[model samples]
Target: MRLARTLRFDQSDENVFERAAQPDEWAVSGAFEFSNWSEDDLSGKRRQAFANGWLGLESFGRATFVATAKIEEQEYRALVERLAAHFVEAWGAPDLETARPVAEKELAFMAGLCDEHEPNTLLIVERSLVTSGVSESFRAIAPQEATLDLVAVHVTSDD
Candidate 1:
């Protein structure tokens, strides 16, 4: 039977690096916030000055996950769409033979966003797996400084 589980970061007492290295064994899936940044604007410059921070699942096996900020609502929506496509292309039915398309699409989508909001986002990437007699699970990683919280729910066949 498959089982689902959720783990909440003990905000009162936990470190991000340590958590990243070794999350709770019982946790199958989880999410958390990371970091932040700020910068001053320069009137004379042609570009806007900005700074930001982020935290999320870094690497899952050979795949590396990354996320950035979204300045406008339109951009945010586009980002979500792109992310979905990325997942589909990277690990969906009828999988592509190459990862180039997924990478290109993701980069192009990101290029359209504002630089100021790029650093303050979360990204998750993982490899595909199959389960039969065992159970299925999900895992999420995030930074502690991001100030975001996640609530995970576990599911089981008996439940």
Candidate 2:
């Protein structure tokens, strides 16, 4: 069964940077710094800064994954759009409509392959480095009808 896993912007703690540095097999690639949040114009803009920061980080991660993973471009772009929506939902944006243009542009680099399949599980990790806050969330969805099996097997078997 095909599944789509998306890491939406849920929340994060201050230790996000530290946690991101750890070796995670699930991670698609190494961490990279996001610089869009360094705008001097947003000094007193707390809410805007927070929103930009979240989106910036999410985009950074998504870009890394799209470049590294051998998935279809359309699938990656859709995932990016979903991520932007997730960011707006979590941060409470003043104008979600305006944000879509920027999100689309950000995802424009991915433009090909429309038959990519989604993953079985999507993991979301958010962190506020400036405030030292962290939030981790995840969601699993099946694309089609399916059944999950739960079985317990003894680690040690007795003859």
Model 2 gets an lDDT of: 0.33
Clashes of 2: 11
Each candidate: RMSD to true structure? 19.5, 12.4
* lDDT, model 2, position 80: 54
Give per-model TM-scores: 0.20, 0.30
TM-score of 1: 0.20
Model 1 alpha-carbon drift over 4 Å, by segment: 1-70, 93-159
User: Across residues 1-159, which tens digit of lDDT does each residue of candidate 2 receive?
Assistant: 122222333334223322221121112211112233333423433322232222223322221011112445565556556645754775454565765665554444222111133443332323233432322222223335454543444465663
* Model 1 agreement with the true structure over 22-135: per-residue lDDT tens digits: 221111111111112112221221011111111122221111223343335564344334444444554452443343454344434334332323342333323222232212
